[model samples]
Target: MMIVCAGLSAVVAGGAGAQHVAVSVQVSSDRQFVPLQSYVQGEVDGKLLFFCGLSDMGLHVFGQGAFPAKNFSRQIVMVDRATGAVTTGTTDHLPLATRQAMTVTAPTAVQYGSILYMYGGYGPDLENPGDYFTRALCTAIDLVQVKNALQASQPVPASAFTHTECVAGKVAGAGIVKLGDRFALICGADADGEYGSAPDPEYTNVVQIFDRNVSYVNPVETLDDGQGFFSPMHRRDVNVLPVRMPVDRAGFVVVCGAFESGIFLYENPLIWGEGDAVPYEDNEFIQHIGGYEGPIASLYSASHDRNHLLIFSGLSGYEYIDNEFVWNPAAPWTRQIVNLHVDGGVFARELVLGEMPWPLTNAKLVLENTLPKTTDGQVLVDQLPFGQPILLGRIYGGIAAEKQGSVSPTYASDAVLDVYVTVTPEGPVEVRPSAFSRVRGLHVSGGLSDLLQSDDLRLVTRPDVFRTSAVPPVQIQVVGTSPLQNPSEIKFTVESRASANNISQRVRLFNYDTQKWEQVDARTMPLSDTTIVVTISTDPARFIDDATGEMKALLQYNALAFTIAPIWQAGQDLTMWTIVP
Candidate 1:
């Protein structure tokens, strides 16, 4: 599933309107602001750096972290957007007392002097019975000390330097950013103060700013909303990241949470406004901001320039799907309807700005008078299937919801969808396979497409692994269908799943070469009434090999309704598969 045949591993090429080629960097973890199970990134020197905090769950083994405190061990392991080089370092030896005062669950980090200041999280302690009771405040780790010792083997920077002390709490949400010439960190409930007699503090609007151009750094209190500052504030799952839009010449911060009602933002931090606040349970704000029209759904706030704010993909129930809506700036909560077209030929579970591994999902819309287009004068389309190819269908699992019956906790078991296509001798033979469901969009690309385009295609396939190491020849069997009159080119595709709001599966293609399975290039085609065979033996070779894995092509599918006895159902039933071995 990782090594797809669509775009090159290091290089990618779209249809015709492709501009500059983009390379994908494997991000180890999510963002730094959240108390992730793994890594986080802190911004320094105008660049994002990566770090890892203590994670027992082993979620992000190579994840990153940002600075949370001044007195803890901090190091700079990566430089933002650097693809050529790799850097690694460690922290200085901690005093016996300092070591005893830290815990892994309470690790902290903060950005200072272009370095991430990391500190203790949940750890064992000698001061209290069992494990608890250390003052949850972490000191900053100096960047200069860590960077200077990069080439050295035992490179733990010295802790003799005095570090700043703030909330030694576990970091969550997005890392703080500077506004104009000021430094600020936007955070919600502090976990350290949440337990025991202290019980931690709840959601509070806190903005700490520092003096300008000072040689020695000392942050000043800029604003505080006392608990109700921004009530219905972000919960644990949501994150607040500051953004300075070009329109108002002011700073604005966006708050995105899970299952939340809408997106929220602060126009000007210096001024205070008594605005109404909406509440949400498990929210996922915005993944990437592409364009905006107005208030998309319930997420809306005042705007200095335009009215809408568009968002791409985010977290939801058992599956993650793409969400597109425009929020009005004046009303902030109302949505202005507009089409935020999806980019095609790319897939992803998560994506970041600039050179991310996948195309931007749920991308927030950027207001522009002119729409984007492809290199060949075609308009850029994100989710819809195109071309003359026939759709082959897909495979997936069934729902586990109580209303769906059975009542098993493991709802999505072994369910599948299969598509079949037939083509005349010469009509159209090119096909693209695309799938959509509650899981977003996954287009079929790579060698499958090449097998469809070229001749001498050999395909070795395994249904279990859903991959082939060799190229697959196009296989077309003539049946009762009429042969194409003036056969030009034939295409095929399969729409086997529902939209991003429902259960969908992935469909891939490969070629058979010599005596093995070779992954091939393929695309998702639009569904149609009449079926067409887009695949023919592009290359001749031996039979498909099942030694490596299952040889049958299988598509994951989920049945929405039951199959009754006497009374017939409206929709198509029974799993479909091509048995041409």
Candidate 2:
């Protein structure tokens, strides 16, 4: 389901002041022989090179028989982007060590030029049965030669592959990116035993840099805040992309990652530049969707001085219900697409673009039509033809969930989709306010009948708190002109000042289903004047009466009598509510 916010501009749209651009996905008819997920891939000369990944959805069990060797992808797969022809090569012809290291799941892989470097993956030991360990090996494959050998159904030449043993390559699910001549492997875990067995998995909190030949080039730099309480860099299975930094420099942005303290997902991102000695955390922006590793594409619009990172469907802590934002504590798998916009390489904001045709995780995008790009591969969107739909790329193998959340059944995705982007002329977006009325105890200090009718801060709405009996509940009614239609968000704003005697204030929403007032923890009282904005994500039909087209909110103020009696005052204009319709 595509949920378009009423006033949101088109994501990644090029041209100065362009506000409308359509981003969409078209499913291809071609299908793979078997499903694959959590794999490493490289694209060269219109051919995609696939290596080291799982053939099944994922391991559901915790320990012991978690990673079964039978589910490991044993063949080297290749796909022709133009013709949709697939070619497979068996790994049995290669050495056991090389085969085992190249076929493990969730290894850090990055393609520079034509060479694909894959490092650190976890799987069953080929030499020792039932024993699974994170491989401390790095394998580099010549994409051109490997693709030729696999197409002819010939044994993969040993010279086409090279393996290196390095202490830094002992982790799995890390993100690898090439900055200049050096490669950086960031944040993953080293599993010593079976999954979830004794000896818990250890997280590598350092970024390991290596040379083109897969040898350590720089001393490992740790990612921590010195206090050692909770570091944002302690993450894995994250989306790391090569981006254009300020002043046309090269850098990397590590997006939302998994398991903060082995439980929650990290919402913010960490950025590193080629000139900097260490990466810094971006705590200002919080990522609500696509919190797991998935297909991502980056574009830089030089004309507009903006960088756009397109994030596909993946696991997230939030979801949209009919276009309204709803928080999900479970961090369920979502099909929502998001665009992270960085203005002038500094300020950032997340825009909810549409969603994919289906839920995809651990997928990869291969650009079919190459556009102008920087040294680090960020597409120069300004160079793209305007007012035309450009074929961005083709999305490949990943895990497809039957439904959202962990309880749903899943399978490795064999589906391929062609992504497209179109930029159009700008148009004005509208935001309207709902008519509001005071239903209960609040006495209007101004002549205004509706507190939300205008944005006049001088118009005050006063509620008497000196009443002896439970100060008659101050109930406010928000009336909509029409019934709830498409997905949209309703924002309730309250600007009020409380006297020194005021202890606490509470806001509650009336639920029609349960016929109860549910307390909403939007903010804490500060005694002084403050403004609180609460976004309502619940279905409008559930809260708004169908017959009256009205929704009610109850405000309760608690105060302790002291030398000065408690008084509460609210700015009528600033306390107005608006909705994205």
Please, what are the lDDT tens digits per residue for candidate 2 over residues 228-264? 3266777888888777777877777888788876777
Where in model 1 is the C-alpha error above 4 Å? 1-52, 56-92, 96-112, 115-138, 167-174, 193-201, 212-219, 226-230, 234-238, 245-248, 258-581
Q: How high a TM-score does candidate 2 get?
A: 0.68
Instruction: Give lDDT per model, in order.
Output: 0.28, 0.68
Q: Across residues 1-581, which tens digit of lDDT does each residue of candidate 1 receive?
A: 22223321111122332221111223233222211222334443323333433322211111112222221223334332222134555432555454443323333344545555444343334345233332334445454454445535455445523444545233333223444455444443443322333443344344444433541134555354444534434333332323223333333333343212323332111211112121221122333332211111111112111111122222222111235323323212111122111122111112221222221111111111132322111222221112112222211111112221112122221212221122111112222222111111122222333323223322122122222213211221111111222122222233222221222222333322443333333333222221223343433112223222112232332212332222211111111112121
Query: After superposition on all CA atoms, how large is the RMSD of candidate 1?
Result: 21.1
Ten residues in a row with the worst lDDT in model 1?
A: 568-577
* RMSD after Cα superposition, model 2: 17.9
Best by TM-score: 2
Report lDDT (Cα) of residue 578, candidate 1. Answer: 24
